[model samples]
Structures are given as structure tokens and as C-alpha cells.
Target: MIRNLLVAALLAGSATVADAAQWNFSYVASVGTISGQIDGTLQGDANTIFVSSLSGLQFNGTPGPALPFLASASSVVGGIPGPPALSLDGSANNILACSTDTVSSGCTSDGFAFVPAGFFAPPPVFFSGPAYGGAFFESYNAANWSITPAAIPEPSSWTMLIAGFGLVGAVVRRRQVVTRAA
Candidate 1:
């Protein structure tokens, strides 16, 4: 019985580890002399990025995207209304970061934007402007961002737990039968 319990405990612990969620994130940006944190999440497929929250964010001493723009979505290159070419470091890289053209249509560059695969590319910079279009652009080395994996269990984790319990029960029952025969 003690052996069975040990096995069950080991199985349960392993299940928790398997269910962990890895999230890569970074929120560092600076315009001129001011910089702040940008909060967001990257989808599992690496196709979409969502800016769920923002705080202490600014550009050249001006408040960045308003609160209403926080929950916006940005898609990959093949996505609809992809982003524009981004300027990182000193050279311009052709990566569709975000679209600042429309705000009401849900494709504004204020919040959502796409990053390259592996989430290693720099985040785009968005400046508040008119809904039609104005001074908005993407820069590679403008912001400080990081990707971190969150510890959240997936459905498979539950399955592992159940299977572990069943194994423990089976081992216990067999042990009891052997003891009775003796």
C-alpha cells in the first residue's frame, strides 16, 4: 500500500509539470527620454498577439494608446490588413507589425500587432492619432518586451491525473489479493 501511494504521488506531481503554460513576454519601450511597460499575450499558434493591459506607457512624454485601445488584436503577415514595415535599430525591416490606419474598424495599430515566429522580434511603436491616419509607425528597437511561459494546466494534464489515480488503485487491489492468498 505504501508503494502504491508513492507511485500515485509521483504521477500527480508529474501531471502538474506537464500542464504548465509557457508565455514569452516583454514590455520595455522608450521615445526620446521617456519609457514604460507594455503588457500583452502571444497566441499559441504564433499568428496573433493581444495587448490586454497597459500601464506607465508613453512616447516622447505623451501618453501612448488610450485605455480603450488596450484590448486590441494584431495578426501575422497573411492576416487581414497586415501591419506596415517596421524600423528597428537603424535599418528598416519589412515586418507587418500593426495597422494604424483604422481605429473604429477594429484594425487599429494602437493595441494589437504581429511579431515574427519565436517571439524574438522587437515590438512595434504606436502613436495616438486621428482615426483616418497620421504619425504612426513601427520600430524594432523602440520598446522593451519579453516572453514568459505561464504555469496553467491544459486538458491533457487532467487526463494524466486520472490515469495516475487508476494505476494506484489497481496496484493497491492486487496487493490486497496477494496478501489474502498468503
Candidate 2:
């Protein structure tokens, strides 16, 4: 039992804490500054869905099919309008190190990271920061950039959780039958 408990604890810790480290930046056009909140969920969770690295994070309008969820990888949040080549300037390459999760301080050129058309789910653009840095995104309103504290749960987590509990129940039933026979 002790061994099992230890194993469980270790697995839990690894799932939630292993990847916890530095942060990166994302550009939310609405906020206009870097903050911590890629879309609505937190990318900080290692187990969750969050881009592990970000180099030059910027997107204008990229048109794709309509998807309800968001993307921690795609620089183009699906179903936007047009990722019209960013309006670059001399400042395009001047990326700030570990800057805002949204709105790069040096992104004065491509100030508009993601300009939405109607309503896209996860903002409509994602950028990765060096694992040592942080990963974040701008809010829908364009207030400031925010960090995605952890990874968000995809559809799989929920399905797995339910199945795990069912397994536990089956084990308990088998033990009960054995005890009654003895």
C-alpha cells in the first residue's frame, strides 16, 4: 500500500508540476500589453495544452474552418478572418525576452497580433516562449498580455477520469466477493 501511495503521489506531482518553469509571451490585440492568460485557460499546466516554446509571436488574420476549441500551437487560431501578413517594421525582429503573454513590447511593428473578425475561441493566435521563458496570450478585449499558467484540459482528460473511477469500482467489487467467500 505504501508503495502504491508513493507511486500515486509521484505520478500526480509529475503530471502537474514537472513542466512548471519559466514563462513566455503572447500578444492579445485587445489588451495591448503582455499579461498571463492565453485565451481563457492557463497554459502553465505542463499536462494541459500549451505551447512549450515561442520565438516570434505575432499573427494578423488567418482564415481557417470554424472550431469551437482553441489552439496552444497554431499561431493562427482556427476560423479567424485573415492572417494577412503582419505589418512588419524594423521592430519586427526585435522580440522582447520573456515579454508579455500578449503584446510584445518590441512588437511595435506588428502591434496587432490577432485581429478577429466575429468571435474566435482561443483568441486566434498563439506564440511559444523558450521553456525557460513563459507562454501567455492577450485577452479578447485587448487590455494586456497574460500568461497561460498551465495546460488546459482537452476532451481526453475528462474521458480518462471517468474511466479511471470505473476501474476503481471494479477492483472494489472483486475484493468484496473474495472476502465474502473466505
Candidate 3:
């Protein structure tokens, strides 16, 4: 009975630790709406979230860029405008480019280009409703965004969790046998 309880407890703890974080995002523009999934990671000791990788990106029913896009949000301070900022390369034509700015034009980069405070209201909030903005090349007038966390466990994490559970079970069982004999 004790062994079962111990194993269960250990397993539960491991499960929690094995969870990985993910980000789900979507945006709407006049040209069309784009939605996709991004692998997310927490920035160091801050209330900021970063998108490390992107996958399953679809823009207006077409496959989107696979480049890495970085996003971050700042809190409103002293009545100053705090908005979520996204960084990506832009082509010479001011079109959204790939991850790197130095990349050649028409390299199929992923990015956004807009004049600050030109279209959307001031102070864009993270994970909030649509943010209206003017996007060059495309008629992207409004952008709706959302962020979601995903849980993914690394292989090493699984291995360590299993090993920990085994160790804990062994210790608990040894204690139980000693108590019985005593």
C-alpha cells in the first residue's frame, strides 16, 4: 500500500515537471488572417515570454514562413504606453522578410512592417484583442493576437523523472520492510 502511494506521488510530480510550454498565436489583417503555433520559453526572471520557434503556420490558407520570430511585451509604466513588440527582418521594399535583416531580398523571410501608431490604437496589449495597424505590401489593417502555453517533455526529463521515481520507490519500500521486521 505504501509503495503504491509513493509511486503515485512520484509519478504525479514527474508529470508536472515534464510539461513543456507552447504558444498559440493568431492575427487578422485586411489581406487575410494568419494563425499558427510557436514554441515558447520564459525569459529570465521577467514577466516576458519569448517565441523560440514556429510551426504549423498558415497565412490565408497558405503555408507561412518557418523563420524564428521574437515577441515581447512591456508593462505600462507611469502612464506610458506599453505594447507587445515583435521583431523580424524587413525587405528593401518594406515587406516582411525572414528572420535576419541581412538576408537577401525575396528570401522568403517572416516579419511585419508598420508605422508606429499609424493604424492601431496606442499601447497594444499582449494576448489581447485585435490591434489595428497598417502593414506594408499587404492590406493588414487589424491584428488579433493570442498566446497559449504548451506542454512538451524532453527525453532527458522523462529519463530523469523515471529514475527519480524508482529511487523514491526503493527508499520507501526499504523503509517499509524495516518497519515490518521491527
Of the candidates shown, which would achieve the greatest TM-score relative to the real structure?
3
Measured by lDDT, the strongest candidate is 3
Cα-based lDDT for every prediction: 0.44, 0.33, 0.44
RMSD of 2: 14.7
Name the better of 2 and 3 by TM-score.
3
- Models 1 onward score TM values of 0.39, 0.28, 0.46
| 1 or 3, greater by TM-score | 3
Candidate 1 off by > 4 Å: 16-24, 31-138, 162-182
Query: Candidate 2, residues 21-82: lDDT per residue as tens digits?
Result: 43434444432333332222123332232223333333322221112222222133333222
Q: Give a tens-digit lDDT track for model 3, residues 31-90.
A: 555666755445454334444556676666676555443322122112223323332211
Residue 76, candidate 2: alpha-carbon lDDT: 38
Per-prediction CA RMSD (Å): 9.5, 14.7, 9.6
Residue-level lDDT of model 1, residues 26-133, one tens digit each, is 333333322334344444544333344434545455655543342222333334343332222212222222234454454445443333333333553433333212
Which residue window of length 10 is worst by lDDT in model 2? 86-95
Distance from true location, Cα of 88 in model 1, Å? 15
The local lDDT score (0 to 100) that residue 106 gets in candidate 1 is 44
